[model samples]
Target: MRILFSGTPAYGHLLPLLPLERAARKAGHTTAFLTHASLGDLVAPAPVLPAGASLEETLDEFHRTTGTNAAEDMSPATAGEFFGGIRVDLGADAALAAAHDFGPDLVVAETADFLGPLAAAHLGVPWASHGVGIALEAPLAEAMWATAAARATARGLALARPFASVDPWPDCLQRDDWKPSRDRITVRPEAHESESGSGSGAGWEAPAFPGREHLPRVLVTLGTIVDDPEALTEIVTSLAGREVNVVVALPPSSADGALPVAGAGVHVTGFVPMRLLLQGMDAVVCSGGAGTVLSVLGAGLPLVIWPLGLDKPLNAERTAALGAAEVVGGAGEAGEAVVRVLEEPSYRAAARKAAADIGAMPRAEDVLPLLTARLG
Candidate 1:
């Protein structure tokens, strides 16, 4: 079976499917990763998202108009609709073109693509949604789903996808949980098999790091943007020249902007293959960006989060309250908190254990078979 996976950025979005790809390939299925060209490095040989892109521009427009960050609003209705615009549809043509070239049996994406649902309908193929439900994205129409019994009996029947905000958020975010879906895969194996949950490091085998093994490494990154760099930088500076080896990822947009450091151990890089680098690192001090947090959590690398904007803070709160991480006020306390985490073996142990759990959870690749069967 051949499957085409579409996502925005390859790092966070594509990763959930990595273990899946490995599984699918091992099972003799062919799979390909499709994403925008600019964001392709994370997934090599990625198909470009057509030229004259507008998502970034539209977001800039949204930011200028709203003066509030996207992550600030947890609700999709209030996420303000920038996500549901035509600007991101710039990639549809390329995605469709790639689909035609690859002639895959299924289309899998995180939530939905920038291109609205029309493209999927146009392709005459089945599409599957995956990812941690973000603020209950544009609600699902009740008329969209097919009866489970009817759909089960008739394999080709289309299921009604639920609205993202069908219910509310979890306890802290909401008063109740969502009306569960029959096909939904929310319990990520990556998050579950961790030492924190039951499946600690089930399928994961840690890769070895030779030279930098001794130092207690702390990966410093606010992900793509520092939402509030002024505040986020404080958290980073706090870790400077301390007990941890601070590897700060300088924003490519920063042109190496000066990040004041006090200690000699603070090393800043334009970029670091953190997923690979984390193999040797002890913990991560991040801005709680969705990508960074999920990646760190999936790796079972416990965290020290200084949420700057958007979903960072919320993700930080949820993961921390659950014992997977620590949420700090700002860069002001980031340094001290990191030291405490490192000096105390419990933090490291918890993170390592969490890593074990994430390893055991069902991964995105696991859905390809079902996706394939539906598309076929």
Candidate 2:
């Protein structure tokens, strides 16, 4: 079977879909990834069909067209305008053209990417929604769908609903009042590592703070999109000052002496895979991006989450409710949160329980048959 995987052009959106994509390829199905060309490197060995504008481009276009700063205003309407309206408007044609060429039996779209479902609808093929994180609020989901439906209607096609949802979020992390919208197929989440072992920091090794071996080690990363050197420096400085060893994961752009807090107790490095970077870390400090939150919890590490924007606030709230993380308002509060998480045993215990629940979910390869069954 030929399967096409699509996602937004960002790590948090794309990486969650990789486990299932890799599973399909391992099962001998022909698979291609559809996203911006800039992310081709992250999904090497699998064919990449470039579609859509980059995140930066789409945001710029949304800002130009709507005269609203997409970054600052993350309301349902504005987010829908950015992700479902402008993104589909700019990339749907390319995505449709590519889908025609690939002729996939199935299209697997990450939750936020509407283009994949649009192409599947045009082609009359079944598509599955692969969730990246916790389920979205009803208003946001409805807004995105309403905007995407407009585009589908304009193209003289009806947007088809997904047959199933491939959810990586474990039962332990789910909200008490929330439920799934469709048939849910639980898949264990794994930290994304490139097939060729050539990712950004593949060969990098964690440094040993020889004298500080007894000190609790914490990782500070803002994920791909939220690159604030000042915030990162403040968090790192705060943690380091508290007799905690800090490791700051710097994006490639900021690797050149951008972070000013690196000192004897603070280590700075480039974008390493979360699987590799989590080694020997006692805890994490992050912006609560889905990828980072899931990876850290999967490793049984507690977190100090200072959400910046987008879905981060929700992710932080959910994880904090699960008792695996602490949500702070700003950088100033992050240090105290991390220290508390380290000193308190409950946080680690909750994280470990979450890890066990996540581990009990079906592996991606095991879910291939379930997805393929929908083809019939």
Indicate which candidate wins on TM-score.
Answer: 2
Q: 1-376 in candidate 2: lDDT tens per residue?
A: 8999999998888899889999999999999998999888788778889998999899899989999998788789997888889999999989999999999999999988999999999999999999998887789888998999898999998998889999998777777888766589999999867676355565678888879888888899999777788999888767757878888987644647457665777888877888888999999999988888889999999999999887788889889988899999989888888889999999999999889888898999999898788667
Residue ranges of candidate 2 with Cα displaced over 4 Å = 252-257
Give the Cα RMSD of candidate 1: 8.3
Instruction: Give the number of the best model, judged by lDDT.
Output: 2
TM-score of each: 0.71, 0.96
Question: Model 1: runs farther than 4 Å from truth?
Answer: 9-11, 18-34, 49-55, 61-75, 78-80, 88-102, 112-116, 132-180, 186-215, 227-233, 252-254, 257-263, 344-346, 363-367, 370-376
- Listed per candidate, the RMSD to the true structure in angstroms reads 8.3, 1.5
Candidate 2 whole-model C-alpha lDDT, 0 to 1: 0.87
Backbone clash count for every predicted candidate, in the order shown: 32, 0
The CA lDDT of each predicted structure is: 0.53, 0.87
Candidate 1 per-residue lDDT over residues 42-94, each given as its tens digit? 44333343322433564566567766454355354333244433323344456
